[model samples]
Target: MACMEFTPEHRGTVRLEAREYGRSVLGAPLLYYPCRSACRLLVFAAIHGEEPETTFLLSRCLRAFDTNFEHVAFVLCANPDGATLGTRGNANGVDLNRNFATSNWNPAHVQSRSILESARDTLLSPGKAPGSEPETQALVALIESLKPESVIAMHSPIGCIDAPARTPLVERLQGTLNLPWKPDIGYPTPGSFGTWCSEHRVECITLELPRLAPELLFERYGESFARFLAAQD
Candidate 1:
């Protein structure tokens, strides 16, 4: 379910922007937390679109915002159509996560991304050029405008904080979720959200959890996640 699935009576803020993804029908739907303290953060989930699990967690967390940060924000469902179709890429086959303009990253353009190709396919098959997809462009616009202190990108199964270059905050996040101390061995992704955050010197934490039912996940990680966000300063 996208941010629009919530009603005005629901809570928080869901504002529609007139922004379009280039000349396509794709538009970035932004869900913001404008209420109120210290540092602000952006929570990005499901850049893959098929990982509705991340979206489910984010939807629950966004409504339960009581953290050290002055504010928290999310893209909600970055790839709406792909999400609706239960696929990994936008309708036009661009991976919004891999489509970002990065100086060191150049994903080879591949078409029609699914579970097999997913984010890599979009980079391998960048249509005309980088940031070509409406989804990619819209994401760029949103992130540039918000300029949050850090971005925690929610993903699945890895359960490690990937610092493309280096960051103490994200490194600490790995420690926060640890059952035992481990090294930050997350591999490098050239055109990924982690890379983007590393480039900007912002904390970009990629949360990896099991692909379980939302109810079960909440029961397991809700308290831990709250503690994680609270330790963000």
Candidate 2:
């Protein structure tokens, strides 16, 4: 992505510092900006490098919100390296997703995203260890600093909402979106934003959108979110 294509504000906060990791070859610099509301939402996309649709969706919604909401968040693309290469790992071949110190952290495959695979080929490996990748470290630090009340980890093609399952907000999300609330689908990811949020006691949504309908994502997810927020009020 051309960093210049984005206006100054879209380029992320000018005061925001740039962090590096994993040779810093494959990814673009991560960015963060403040929201208009006291409450904030952390939107992550392209965790799986193959799922580029979510990134576009997130970008669209963010620019749209910049025009519409008058309030949004520091939309951060957690792994620019992976996103650029269209691979699950960073330039160093580490599956930084699995690098988190979550309970299910994998030791072997974590060092190599290519080693681990699932039915749908979602690589659930971390790097040699949690917080290994600079990308991951930057994300962890951002999450810790922001301590957002709500979060949305964007993933794709599932078209459903999944979380810790026990969160009452899941039901509220289910009712609003008419999507099922599911358990942490056995794909154990240690130190992942989702699991990390659980540890921090933050209510989050792992919103899985269909890779095909990139345009309608905000409409679909936002409609549900708007309804959910209204109910909370």
lDDT of 1 by residue, 99-152 (tens): 666775575654433343256343334435666777666666666766777777
**lDDT for every model?**
0.57, 0.59
Top candidate (TM-score) = 2
Stretch of 10 with least lDDT, candidate 1: 14-23
Candidate 2: deviation at residue 146, Å? 0.9
Best by lDDT: 2
Cα lDDT tens digits for candidate 2, 119-226: 343434567676677777777776677667777787766667888654665666677667666776455555666777777787778877654555566566644454
Write down the lDDT that model 2 would get: 0.59
Residue 201 alpha-carbon offset, candidate 2, angstroms: 2.0
Listed in order, each prediction's TM-score against the native is 0.70, 0.71
CA-only RMSD, every prediction: 6.3, 6.7
**What's model 2's TM-score?**
0.71
